[model samples]
Target: MSRYDWNDERHALGVATMDATHREFLELARAIESGPPAEFATRFEGLVEHTRAHFAAEEALMRETACPSLREHEADHARVLGDLGRFLQSVAKGRPAMARAYIASGLSEWFDLHVATMDAQLAAHLNARQHAG
Candidate 1:
Protein backbone atom coordinates (compact mmCIF):
# COMPACT_ATOMS: atom_id res chain seq x y z
CA MET A 1 0.00 0.00 0.00
CA SER A 2 1.35 3.40 -1.00
CA ARG A 3 1.48 5.94 1.81
CA TYR A 4 0.31 9.35 0.63
CA ASP A 5 2.97 12.00 0.09
CA TRP A 6 3.55 15.02 -2.12
CA ASN A 7 6.68 13.45 -3.60
CA ASP A 8 4.61 10.97 -5.52
CA GLU A 9 4.74 12.87 -8.82
CA ARG A 10 1.54 11.28 -10.10
CA HIS A 11 -0.26 13.92 -8.07
CA ALA A 12 1.33 16.67 -10.11
CA LEU A 13 -0.56 18.38 -12.93
CA GLY A 14 2.40 20.22 -14.52
CA VAL A 15 0.42 23.37 -13.85
CA ALA A 16 2.21 25.16 -11.04
CA THR A 17 -0.87 26.57 -9.30
CA MET A 18 -2.80 23.35 -9.61
CA ASP A 19 0.23 21.30 -8.66
CA ALA A 20 0.75 23.45 -5.58
CA THR A 21 -2.85 23.01 -4.57
CA HIS A 22 -2.51 19.28 -5.01
CA ARG A 23 0.61 19.35 -2.85
CA GLU A 24 -1.33 21.17 -0.17
CA PHE A 25 -4.01 18.54 -0.38
CA LEU A 26 -1.39 15.85 0.11
CA GLU A 27 0.05 17.80 3.03
CA LEU A 28 -3.35 17.89 4.67
CA ALA A 29 -3.78 14.17 4.14
CA ARG A 30 -0.36 13.52 5.60
CA ALA A 31 -1.05 15.76 8.56
CA ILE A 32 -4.27 13.92 9.27
CA GLU A 33 -2.27 10.76 9.60
CA SER A 34 0.57 12.20 11.69
CA GLY A 35 -0.81 15.16 13.61
CA PRO A 36 -2.65 15.37 16.93
CA PRO A 37 -6.32 14.50 16.97
CA ALA A 38 -7.51 18.09 16.99
CA GLU A 39 -5.03 19.03 14.29
CA PHE A 40 -6.11 16.05 12.27
CA ALA A 41 -9.75 17.08 12.60
CA THR A 42 -8.92 20.55 11.36
CA ARG A 43 -6.92 19.23 8.44
CA PHE A 44 -9.59 16.72 7.59
CA GLU A 45 -12.23 19.42 7.40
CA GLY A 46 -9.92 21.50 5.25
CA LEU A 47 -9.42 18.49 3.03
CA VAL A 48 -13.12 18.01 2.45
CA GLU A 49 -13.86 21.69 2.02
CA HIS A 50 -10.95 22.36 -0.29
CA THR A 51 -11.93 19.33 -2.34
CA ARG A 52 -15.36 20.81 -3.00
CA ALA A 53 -13.89 24.16 -3.92
CA HIS A 54 -11.32 22.58 -6.19
CA PHE A 55 -13.94 20.53 -7.95
CA ALA A 56 -16.07 23.61 -8.48
CA ALA A 57 -13.16 25.52 -9.92
CA GLU A 58 -12.29 22.70 -12.29
CA GLU A 59 -15.88 22.22 -13.38
CA ALA A 60 -16.20 25.89 -14.15
CA LEU A 61 -13.07 25.72 -16.25
CA MET A 62 -14.44 22.72 -18.09
CA ARG A 63 -17.72 24.41 -18.82
CA GLU A 64 -16.03 27.59 -19.95
CA THR A 65 -13.85 25.64 -22.36
CA ALA A 66 -16.64 23.35 -23.53
CA CYS A 67 -14.53 20.35 -22.63
CA PRO A 68 -15.80 17.20 -24.30
CA SER A 69 -15.42 15.32 -21.02
CA LEU A 70 -17.21 17.91 -18.89
CA ARG A 71 -20.04 15.62 -17.89
CA GLU A 72 -17.71 12.73 -17.18
CA HIS A 73 -15.40 14.99 -15.18
CA GLU A 74 -18.27 16.28 -13.08
CA ALA A 75 -19.46 12.76 -12.53
CA ASP A 76 -16.04 11.72 -11.27
CA HIS A 77 -15.97 14.70 -8.93
CA ALA A 78 -19.34 13.72 -7.45
CA ARG A 79 -18.24 10.16 -6.97
CA VAL A 80 -15.09 11.28 -5.20
CA LEU A 81 -17.07 13.50 -2.87
CA GLY A 82 -19.46 10.68 -2.13
CA ASP A 83 -16.54 8.51 -1.10
CA LEU A 84 -15.11 11.34 0.98
CA GLY A 85 -18.45 11.76 2.71
CA ARG A 86 -18.37 8.15 3.75
CA PHE A 87 -14.86 8.60 5.09
CA LEU A 88 -15.74 11.75 6.99
CA GLN A 89 -18.98 10.31 8.37
CA SER A 90 -17.13 7.29 9.62
CA VAL A 91 -14.48 9.50 11.18
CA ALA A 92 -17.19 11.54 12.85
CA LYS A 93 -18.20 8.43 14.75
CA GLY A 94 -14.59 8.14 16.03
CA ARG A 95 -13.47 5.53 13.56
CA PRO A 96 -10.04 6.98 12.89
CA ALA A 97 -8.63 3.64 11.79
CA MET A 98 -11.20 3.25 9.08
CA ALA A 99 -10.82 6.86 8.09
CA ARG A 100 -7.07 6.57 7.83
CA ALA A 101 -7.37 3.45 5.77
CA TYR A 102 -9.73 5.21 3.46
CA ILE A 103 -7.42 8.16 3.22
CA ALA A 104 -4.39 6.01 2.53
CA SER A 105 -6.01 3.94 -0.13
CA GLY A 106 -9.19 5.40 -1.54
CA LEU A 107 -8.04 8.99 -1.49
CA SER A 108 -4.78 8.16 -3.20
CA GLU A 109 -6.49 5.96 -5.73
CA TRP A 110 -9.09 8.57 -6.60
CA PHE A 111 -6.49 11.29 -6.86
CA ASP A 112 -4.37 9.20 -9.21
CA LEU A 113 -7.38 8.59 -11.38
CA HIS A 114 -8.51 12.20 -11.20
CA VAL A 115 -5.15 13.70 -11.93
CA ALA A 116 -4.29 11.38 -14.79
CA THR A 117 -7.61 11.53 -16.58
CA MET A 118 -10.14 14.09 -15.35
CA ASP A 119 -7.87 16.88 -14.16
CA ALA A 120 -5.38 16.43 -16.97
CA GLN A 121 -8.11 16.87 -19.55
CA LEU A 122 -9.52 19.83 -17.68
CA ALA A 123 -6.13 21.48 -17.40
CA ALA A 124 -5.48 21.07 -21.11
CA HIS A 125 -8.91 22.52 -21.84
CA LEU A 126 -8.21 25.45 -19.54
CA ASN A 127 -4.89 26.07 -21.23
CA ALA A 128 -6.68 26.25 -24.53
CA ARG A 129 -9.21 28.63 -23.01
CA GLN A 130 -6.40 30.81 -21.76
CA HIS A 131 -4.93 31.16 -25.22
CA ALA A 132 -8.31 31.57 -26.89
CA GLY A 133 -9.30 34.29 -24.46
Candidate 2:
Protein backbone atom coordinates (compact mmCIF):
# COMPACT_ATOMS: atom_id res chain seq x y z
CA MET A 1 0.00 0.00 0.00
CA SER A 2 1.08 3.59 -0.46
CA ARG A 3 2.55 5.15 2.64
CA TYR A 4 -0.05 7.93 2.70
CA ASP A 5 -3.00 7.42 0.45
CA TRP A 6 -5.41 10.34 -0.04
CA ASN A 7 -8.97 9.27 0.57
CA ASP A 8 -11.61 11.19 -1.35
CA GLU A 9 -13.95 11.64 1.58
CA ARG A 10 -11.22 13.12 3.72
CA HIS A 11 -9.16 14.88 1.11
CA ALA A 12 -11.47 16.17 -1.57
CA LEU A 13 -12.45 19.83 -1.16
CA GLY A 14 -14.92 19.98 -4.12
CA VAL A 15 -12.81 22.79 -5.54
CA ALA A 16 -10.78 21.61 -8.47
CA THR A 17 -7.66 23.67 -7.82
CA MET A 18 -7.64 22.98 -4.11
CA ASP A 19 -8.31 19.29 -4.60
CA ALA A 20 -5.51 18.99 -7.12
CA THR A 21 -3.06 20.77 -4.82
CA HIS A 22 -4.15 18.56 -1.94
CA ARG A 23 -3.54 15.47 -4.05
CA GLU A 24 -0.03 16.71 -4.69
CA PHE A 25 0.39 17.24 -0.95
CA LEU A 26 -0.54 13.63 -0.20
CA GLU A 27 1.71 12.31 -2.95
CA LEU A 28 4.64 14.29 -1.63
CA ALA A 29 3.95 13.11 1.90
CA ARG A 30 3.86 9.53 0.68
CA ALA A 31 7.14 9.98 -1.15
CA ILE A 32 8.78 11.39 1.95
CA GLU A 33 7.42 8.64 4.15
CA SER A 34 8.58 5.80 1.92
CA GLY A 35 11.82 7.26 0.67
CA PRO A 36 15.18 5.88 1.79
CA PRO A 37 16.92 7.49 4.74
CA ALA A 38 19.56 8.95 2.48
CA GLU A 39 16.89 10.61 0.39
CA PHE A 40 14.52 11.46 3.18
CA ALA A 41 15.76 15.01 3.66
CA THR A 42 15.49 15.83 -0.01
CA ARG A 43 12.08 14.29 -0.28
CA PHE A 44 10.95 16.12 2.79
CA GLU A 45 12.26 19.34 1.33
CA GLY A 46 10.12 18.76 -1.73
CA LEU A 47 7.08 18.31 0.45
CA VAL A 48 7.90 21.53 2.28
CA GLU A 49 8.19 23.41 -0.98
CA HIS A 50 4.93 21.99 -2.23
CA THR A 51 3.22 22.92 1.01
CA ARG A 52 4.57 26.47 0.89
CA ALA A 53 3.21 26.93 -2.58
CA HIS A 54 -0.07 25.24 -1.73
CA PHE A 55 -0.67 27.47 1.25
CA ALA A 56 0.23 30.57 -0.70
CA ALA A 57 -2.19 29.70 -3.47
CA GLU A 58 -4.95 29.04 -1.02
CA GLU A 59 -4.29 32.27 0.80
CA ALA A 60 -4.46 34.16 -2.47
CA LEU A 61 -7.81 32.60 -3.27
CA MET A 62 -9.12 33.50 0.15
CA ARG A 63 -8.06 37.11 -0.34
CA GLU A 64 -9.59 37.25 -3.79
CA THR A 65 -12.84 35.82 -2.54
CA ALA A 66 -12.75 37.90 0.65
CA CYS A 67 -13.46 34.73 2.55
CA PRO A 68 -15.06 35.42 5.88
CA SER A 69 -12.65 33.15 7.67
CA LEU A 70 -9.62 34.53 5.92
CA ARG A 71 -7.79 35.45 9.10
CA GLU A 72 -8.42 32.11 10.72
CA HIS A 73 -7.44 30.22 7.60
CA GLU A 74 -4.28 32.22 7.17
CA ALA A 75 -3.43 31.67 10.82
CA ASP A 76 -3.77 27.94 10.39
CA HIS A 77 -1.51 28.02 7.37
CA ALA A 78 1.04 30.09 9.24
CA ARG A 79 1.12 27.72 12.16
CA VAL A 80 1.66 24.67 9.98
CA LEU A 81 4.21 26.39 7.80
CA GLY A 82 6.15 27.40 10.89
CA ASP A 83 6.20 23.81 12.04
CA LEU A 84 7.33 22.64 8.63
CA GLY A 85 10.05 25.26 8.57
CA ARG A 86 11.44 24.06 11.86
CA PHE A 87 11.35 20.48 10.64
CA LEU A 88 13.16 21.54 7.49
CA GLN A 89 15.90 23.10 9.57
CA SER A 90 16.31 19.87 11.44
CA VAL A 91 16.48 17.90 8.22
CA ALA A 92 19.10 20.27 6.86
CA LYS A 93 21.23 19.49 9.87
CA GLY A 94 21.06 15.80 8.92
CA ARG A 95 18.76 15.15 11.82
CA PRO A 96 15.72 13.83 10.03
CA ALA A 97 14.54 11.60 12.84
CA MET A 98 12.06 14.19 14.10
CA ALA A 99 10.87 15.00 10.61
CA ARG A 100 10.40 11.32 9.79
CA ALA A 101 8.42 10.78 12.94
CA TYR A 102 6.22 13.78 12.11
CA ILE A 103 5.67 12.50 8.57
CA ALA A 104 4.80 9.02 9.77
CA SER A 105 2.52 10.12 12.56
CA GLY A 106 1.71 13.80 12.83
CA LEU A 107 1.33 14.89 9.23
CA SER A 108 -1.45 12.58 8.08
CA GLU A 109 -3.52 13.31 11.15
CA TRP A 110 -2.97 17.03 10.79
CA PHE A 111 -3.86 16.97 7.10
CA ASP A 112 -7.12 15.18 7.80
CA LEU A 113 -8.19 17.74 10.36
CA HIS A 114 -7.03 20.72 8.33
CA VAL A 115 -8.80 19.57 5.20
CA ALA A 116 -12.01 18.74 7.00
CA THR A 117 -12.19 22.00 8.89
CA MET A 118 -10.43 25.00 7.43
CA ASP A 119 -10.23 23.82 3.83
CA ALA A 120 -13.81 22.58 3.75
CA GLN A 121 -15.06 25.91 5.00
CA LEU A 122 -13.02 27.74 2.41
CA ALA A 123 -14.31 25.53 -0.36
CA ALA A 124 -17.89 25.99 0.71
CA HIS A 125 -17.50 29.74 0.74
CA LEU A 126 -15.88 29.71 -2.65
CA ASN A 127 -18.58 27.50 -4.10
CA ALA A 128 -21.31 29.67 -2.71
CA ARG A 129 -19.74 32.76 -4.20
CA GLN A 130 -19.32 31.07 -7.56
CA HIS A 131 -22.95 30.02 -7.61
CA ALA A 132 -24.12 33.46 -6.52
CA GLY A 133 -22.16 35.38 -9.11
Candidate 3:
Protein backbone atom coordinates (compact mmCIF):
# COMPACT_ATOMS: atom_id res chain seq x y z
CA MET A 1 0.00 0.00 0.00
CA SER A 2 1.07 3.58 -0.61
CA ARG A 3 2.48 5.47 2.32
CA TYR A 4 -0.38 7.92 1.94
CA ASP A 5 -3.01 5.25 2.49
CA TRP A 6 -5.00 5.85 5.66
CA ASN A 7 -4.74 3.37 8.52
CA ASP A 8 -7.57 3.57 11.00
CA GLU A 9 -5.43 2.24 13.84
CA ARG A 10 -2.87 4.91 13.23
CA HIS A 11 -4.95 7.81 12.00
CA ALA A 12 -8.36 7.53 13.58
CA LEU A 13 -8.89 9.65 16.70
CA GLY A 14 -12.50 8.70 17.55
CA VAL A 15 -13.70 12.17 16.64
CA ALA A 16 -16.09 11.75 13.76
CA THR A 17 -15.41 15.03 11.93
CA MET A 18 -11.71 14.94 12.52
CA ASP A 19 -11.49 11.31 11.49
CA ALA A 20 -13.38 11.94 8.30
CA THR A 21 -11.28 14.97 7.43
CA HIS A 22 -8.07 13.05 8.07
CA ARG A 23 -9.28 10.21 5.92
CA GLU A 24 -10.10 12.62 3.12
CA PHE A 25 -6.66 14.19 3.46
CA LEU A 26 -4.93 10.87 3.04
CA GLU A 27 -7.10 10.05 0.05
CA LEU A 28 -6.34 13.36 -1.59
CA ALA A 29 -2.63 13.04 -0.98
CA ARG A 30 -2.63 9.54 -2.34
CA ALA A 31 -4.40 10.70 -5.45
CA ILE A 32 -1.92 13.49 -6.00
CA GLU A 33 1.04 11.18 -5.51
CA SER A 34 -0.30 8.52 -7.83
CA GLY A 35 -1.95 10.66 -10.50
CA PRO A 36 -0.48 11.02 -13.96
CA PRO A 37 2.48 13.34 -14.44
CA ALA A 38 0.47 15.75 -16.55
CA GLU A 39 -2.11 16.07 -13.83
CA PHE A 40 0.33 16.45 -10.95
CA ALA A 41 0.07 20.21 -10.69
CA THR A 42 -3.70 20.23 -10.82
CA ARG A 43 -4.03 17.48 -8.26
CA PHE A 44 -1.52 19.12 -5.99
CA GLU A 45 -3.46 22.34 -6.18
CA GLY A 46 -6.57 20.50 -5.11
CA LEU A 47 -4.71 19.04 -2.15
CA VAL A 48 -3.51 22.46 -1.14
CA GLU A 49 -7.04 23.79 -1.25
CA HIS A 50 -8.35 20.87 0.76
CA THR A 51 -5.64 21.35 3.36
CA ARG A 52 -6.53 25.00 3.78
CA ALA A 53 -10.14 24.16 4.42
CA HIS A 54 -9.20 21.26 6.68
CA PHE A 55 -6.95 23.40 8.84
CA ALA A 56 -9.52 26.17 8.99
CA ALA A 57 -12.18 23.77 10.18
CA GLU A 58 -9.90 22.39 12.87
CA GLU A 59 -9.00 25.86 14.04
CA ALA A 60 -12.66 26.73 14.19
CA LEU A 61 -13.27 23.70 16.37
CA MET A 62 -10.43 24.69 18.63
CA ARG A 63 -11.87 28.16 18.99
CA GLU A 64 -15.43 27.05 19.64
CA THR A 65 -14.31 24.49 22.23
CA ALA A 66 -11.58 26.62 23.80
CA CYS A 67 -8.93 24.02 23.17
CA PRO A 68 -5.87 24.51 25.37
CA SER A 69 -3.43 23.90 22.56
CA LEU A 70 -4.97 26.40 20.22
CA ARG A 71 -1.92 28.57 19.79
CA GLU A 72 0.47 25.71 19.24
CA HIS A 73 -1.89 23.98 16.87
CA GLU A 74 -2.50 27.17 14.93
CA ALA A 75 1.22 27.73 14.64
CA ASP A 76 1.73 24.26 13.29
CA HIS A 77 -1.06 24.77 10.81
CA ALA A 78 0.41 28.07 9.70
CA ARG A 79 3.82 26.51 9.19
CA VAL A 80 2.43 23.76 7.01
CA LEU A 81 0.26 26.14 5.06
CA GLY A 82 3.24 28.36 4.36
CA ASP A 83 5.21 25.39 3.11
CA LEU A 84 2.32 24.31 0.92
CA GLY A 85 2.00 27.78 -0.54
CA ARG A 86 5.65 27.80 -1.53
CA PHE A 87 5.38 24.34 -3.03
CA LEU A 88 2.26 25.30 -4.92
CA GLN A 89 4.05 28.26 -6.42
CA SER A 90 6.75 25.97 -7.73
CA VAL A 91 4.25 23.50 -9.04
CA ALA A 92 2.37 26.25 -10.81
CA LYS A 93 5.57 27.28 -12.49
CA GLY A 94 6.11 23.87 -14.05
CA ARG A 95 8.77 22.92 -11.51
CA PRO A 96 7.23 20.08 -9.57
CA ALA A 97 10.25 17.95 -8.74
CA MET A 98 10.75 19.22 -5.21
CA ALA A 99 7.04 19.48 -4.56
CA ARG A 100 6.54 15.93 -5.77
CA ALA A 101 9.24 14.67 -3.43
CA TYR A 102 7.70 16.57 -0.54
CA ILE A 103 4.25 15.17 -1.27
CA ALA A 104 5.61 11.65 -1.61
CA SER A 105 7.58 11.59 1.64
CA GLY A 106 7.63 14.74 3.76
CA LEU A 107 3.87 15.20 3.81
CA SER A 108 3.17 11.58 4.69
CA GLU A 109 5.67 11.61 7.55
CA TRP A 110 4.37 14.92 8.83
CA PHE A 111 0.77 13.77 8.67
CA ASP A 112 1.52 10.68 10.74
CA LEU A 113 3.19 12.64 13.50
CA HIS A 114 0.68 15.49 13.47
CA VAL A 115 -2.27 13.11 13.73
CA ALA A 116 -0.70 11.06 16.51
CA THR A 117 0.19 14.07 18.62
CA MET A 118 -1.63 17.33 17.96
CA ASP A 119 -4.82 15.86 16.60
CA ALA A 120 -4.89 13.12 19.20
CA GLN A 121 -4.67 15.68 21.96
CA LEU A 122 -7.43 17.73 20.43
CA ALA A 123 -9.65 14.69 20.03
CA ALA A 124 -9.17 13.69 23.64
CA HIS A 125 -9.89 17.19 24.86
CA LEU A 126 -13.02 17.37 22.75
CA ASN A 127 -14.24 14.04 24.00
CA ALA A 128 -13.62 15.02 27.58
CA ARG A 129 -15.48 18.28 27.08
CA GLN A 130 -18.39 16.48 25.56
CA HIS A 131 -18.59 13.99 28.41
CA ALA A 132 -18.19 16.66 31.07
CA GLY A 133 -20.93 18.74 29.57
Highest lDDT: give the candidate number. Answer: 3
Query: How would you encode candidate 2's per-residue C-alpha lDDT over 15-132 as one tens digit per residue?
Result: 9999999998888888777778888988888999999999999999999989999999899889989999999999898888888889988888888998999999999999999999
The list of candidate 3 runs beyond 4 A from truth reads none
Give residue 97's error in model 1 in angstroms.
2.9
Query: For every model shown, what is its TM-score relative to the native structure?
Result: 0.83, 0.96, 0.98
Clashing pairs in 2: none
Quote the positional error of residue 79 for candidate 2 in Å: 0.8
Candidate 1 lDDT, 2-109, residue by residue in tens: 366766467666667778778777777777777787666557777999989888877886777688999988998899898788878877877767677777677887
Backbone clashes counted, model 1: 0
Evaluated at residue 89, the lDDT of candidate 2 is 100
lDDT by residue for model 3 over 1-133, one digit each (tens)? 8998889889989999999999999999998877899989989999999999999999999999999999999999999999999999998888999899998799999999999999999999999999999
Evaluate model 2: give its TM-score: 0.96
- Superposed Cα deviation of residue 110, candidate 3 (Å): 0.4
Candidate 3: Cα lDDT at 19: 93
Clashes of each: 0, 0, 0
Q: RMSD in angstroms, all models?
A: 2.5, 1.0, 0.6
